[model samples]
Target: MARRPKLFEAAPGSPAETRCQLCERAVRHTSRHHLVPREEGGRYGPTVDLCQPCHSSVHLLLTNKELARRYHTVEDLQRAEELQKYLHWIRRSRVERITNRRRRR
Candidate 1:
């Protein structure tokens, strides 16, 4: 068995600083998003580290197919007009955490 490298580890003498790749904000909490989902045959691709609000917003706003097909890169996500507006609001709001409400089916 192989071990996965730590993605959030800081240098020996420094504290770990996690930042949202899309919103470009320094966050104390973050979630890792695979650019292409593992279920979508993205076994080994890029991962975007995002704050909770950004991470939740991605899933809330886009489907997995969309994530895999279109918003699969940091640049792709940042350039989205819809997300740009959302990012602006979140930045002004200065929220550090977000809780996703259960979707009604």
Candidate 2:
């Protein structure tokens, strides 16, 4: 049997161009962060790269009782279209921030 390739290797090229989904910072040492908890059948497809700080922040959000309470099951997270929308929104926002920073330089 063959070992599975690392996500970065599987999707080769430069991650710096990929952009962090949370802060829109250049993704250095990028790692896939699942928007929905993986335990709830959230696979890699629903993943996005996030910088360390943003990644930590995401986990923090999940830790919140209110959010956790709202999402009682993996189906709840998956079925909630707003969650997907929010992920896209965060990615776009980050991209905008990155573009703005580039303009400032």
Candidate 3:
């Protein structure tokens, strides 16, 4: 099977840091999330730079079809009840990056 290309790749000498559009935090690495997924015939629309945790939470909480149908914007995503809860809790996190490791609390 062919490997999928990365969603967003930095230019040769682009800035190293970028702000996460969701939680308003600084992140060294970001993932690109399409508001309308390619599978849903959404080619061009809004996309956001999200930190790993935010990106994971989105997929965990909503289906791609749901994202394309209802939450197709950053504001829409922020308004999601589950996403709001995650964002609220994440706000107090001192860690810059959130990984797949399960937290004790």
Candidate 4:
């Protein structure tokens, strides 16, 4: 049988832990999300920490071009209709990590 991915313990207030910018959930691990696509010339630009699921959802819902042109800031990303729905759903869960199923074009 395949093993499950490990979940970080739900220890509130750990110094190393941070909140997901999108879902606003406190999680142990966070991946940096480039405000603009690196290929679109934001290699040295701003970034925000997001949980894996939230980060993956952003890429899944919006194209790199869209991210580079429109959703380049956390405030902009938060206002996106596509992401607003996802944020609402994910915020209800206490689990720090959730599985993301990528959609094929």
Candidate 5:
């Protein structure tokens, strides 16, 4: 029998070990998303745990231009109370979107 490497060990120093900063979901097989734009001095921080669908939805619904203008990195977001508020807002919005779609029978 072969032993699989722990996810954290495979991706050493990854932020996925932490629950999604937005929805509080445990991150698994997650991709790294810069809360702040790297080009704008954004660095890594708490990340959202989005299953592939959720991750795609976020990018589709929220434009890159908007993200670039709003948050360049997690560090930048942590500095602003308003952005923090929006983090929760975005989480709720995602839940609502998912729920509403499920209920549209």
Candidate 6:
């Protein structure tokens, strides 16, 4: 028999959070992230589902040029030295959503 999806893994009508490709956490909310930036001619490129904090961290740490040139794949992003510290901390935390934050203009 096929394995059943866990509680948050299954969303009836809406797309569930599933697993974050980066931190490997199952968040209640997730966003699709393009490996190659959409603005950098990757509008139709590959994407991975990332949790809110992981997704936000990616943008906060890297620029579109860096993403397009270096960290365009999940494996590459995971090995990024800049994200090591944040990843280590987030992996041990239970908080799904990062509370305090600022929006980039």
Per TM-score, the best of the predicted structures is 4
Q: Where is model 4 more than 4 Å wrong at Cα?
A: 1-11
> Positional deviation of 96 in candidate 2, in angstroms?
19
As a whole number from 0 to 100, the lDDT of residue 19 in candidate 1 is: 67
Kindly list the per-residue Cα lDDT of model 4 for residues 1-105, writing each as its tens digit: 998666665567777668888888888889999999899999999999999889989999999999999999999999999888888888887666556457787
Candidate 5 per-residue C-alpha lDDT over 31-93 given as tens digits, one digit per residue, 9 for 90 to 100: 567654455445554354444434444454455555677655444434445444545555444
TM agreement with the true structure for every prediction = 0.76, 0.41, 0.72, 0.84, 0.38, 0.78
Please state the error at residue 19 of candidate 5 in Å.
Answer: 2.0
Q: Against the true structure, whose lDDT is highest? A: 4
Residue 36 deviation, candidate 2, in Å?
Answer: 1.7
The TM-score of candidate 1 is 0.76
Query: What's the TM for model 2?
Result: 0.41
**Using lDDT as the measure, what is the rank order of every candidate, best first?**
4, 6, 1, 3, 2, 5
Using TM-score as the yardstick, the better of models 2 and 3 is: 3
lDDT per model, in order? 0.76, 0.48, 0.76, 0.86, 0.47, 0.83
Which residue runs does candidate 1 get wrong by more than 4 Å?
1-16
Off by over 4 Å in 6: 1-17, 99-105
Residue-wise C-alpha lDDT for candidate 2, range 9-73, written one tens digit per residue: 22336644555555554544557766555655555535666655445544544543433456544
Model 6, span 27-80: residue lDDT tens: 677789999999999999999999888988888888888999999999999999
Provide the clash count, candidate 1: 0
RMSD of 3: 8.2
Report the Cα lDDT for residue 37, model 4. 85
Task: Write one digit per residue (lDDT tens) for candidate 3, span 34-61.
Answer: 9898788677766899888888888877
- Please state the error at residue 54 of candidate 4 in Å: 0.3
Q: Which of 4 and 5 is ahead in lDDT?
A: 4
Q: After superposition, how far is residue 103 of candidate 6 from its true place, in Å?
A: 6.9
